[model samples]
Target: MDLRSRIEASYKRIAQEAYDKGYADSIKDIMDLRFGGMPDESLAALREIKDVAVMRSIQNAALSWDRDEVLTLIAQSRSA
Candidate 1:
């Protein structure tokens, strides 16, 4: 690809990573409040998600659902 295209791709990747970290931290904060801490498996699953929109939706869901339901939503999203 051209230099400009390469730079744009790098910037996009950086932005996505930043967004993922922000959302993942939000999810962890909610989990900590609800469960006193989150399970390692759940944290792993959250990190595995690369889509920022999915991460945002999951973070919102985490506020209301129990841990298992949050996990189930992650599992279902992966299958889809």
Candidate 2:
């Protein structure tokens, strides 16, 4: 690739990684407050999720759904 394209690709990758980390941290924060705390395994699994849509959906679900339901979603997301 050209230098410009290489730079753009690097920037995009960095941006996505930052977004994923920030989103994952926020998810943990919300879970801690809403559910008292999350299981360690689930928290680790959540960090492994690269899909922002799935992460956001889990975060949104945690805000309203019961702890059990949210846990189920997290587990499934990790598997996917």
Candidate 3:
């Protein structure tokens, strides 16, 4: 699959698993399974988000939490 499709699929799978497990804190576990544990840079970047909506947008996307995307999203989220 293409990158976007892969991302969407992974997101769906993670969401389903989280729902089935009744786990609200499954984001880290999902990210680890989708992209191998979260990188330090990504974690640092995620720490910057202050808006719930923007943070949810990033969370809902299929995109992997690689360092650059993480930082970019966090920056955008803070601005939003």
TM-score of each: 0.76, 0.87, 0.44
- Candidate 2, residues 1-80: lDDT per residue as tens digits? 99999999999999999999998899888888877889999989988999878887888888785678778888898777
Report the C-alpha lDDT of model 3 over 1-80, residue by residue, as the tens digit. 89999999999989866553332134445566767766565555565544455556556652455534544665665455
Q: Could you give me the TM-score of model 3 versus the true structure?
A: 0.44
Better of 2 and 3 by lDDT: 2
Candidate 1 lDDT over residue span 18-38, tens digit each: 888788888888988887877
**For each candidate, what is the lDDT?**
0.80, 0.86, 0.57
Spell out the clash pairs found in candidate 3: none
Tell me how many clashing residue pairs each candidate has.
Answer: 0, 0, 0
Task: Tell me how far candidate 3 lies from the true structure as C-alpha RMSD in angstroms.
Answer: 13.1
Report the number of backbone clashes for model 3. Answer: 0
Worst 10 residues of 3 by lDDT: 19-28
Error of 3 at 19 (Å): 17
Report how far residue 7 has shifted in candidate 3, in Å: 43
Native-vs-model 1 lDDT? 0.80
Which parts of model 3 have CA positions greater than 4 angstroms off? 1-26, 63-71, 75-80
Q: 1 or 2, which is superior by TM-score?
A: 2
Best by lDDT: 2
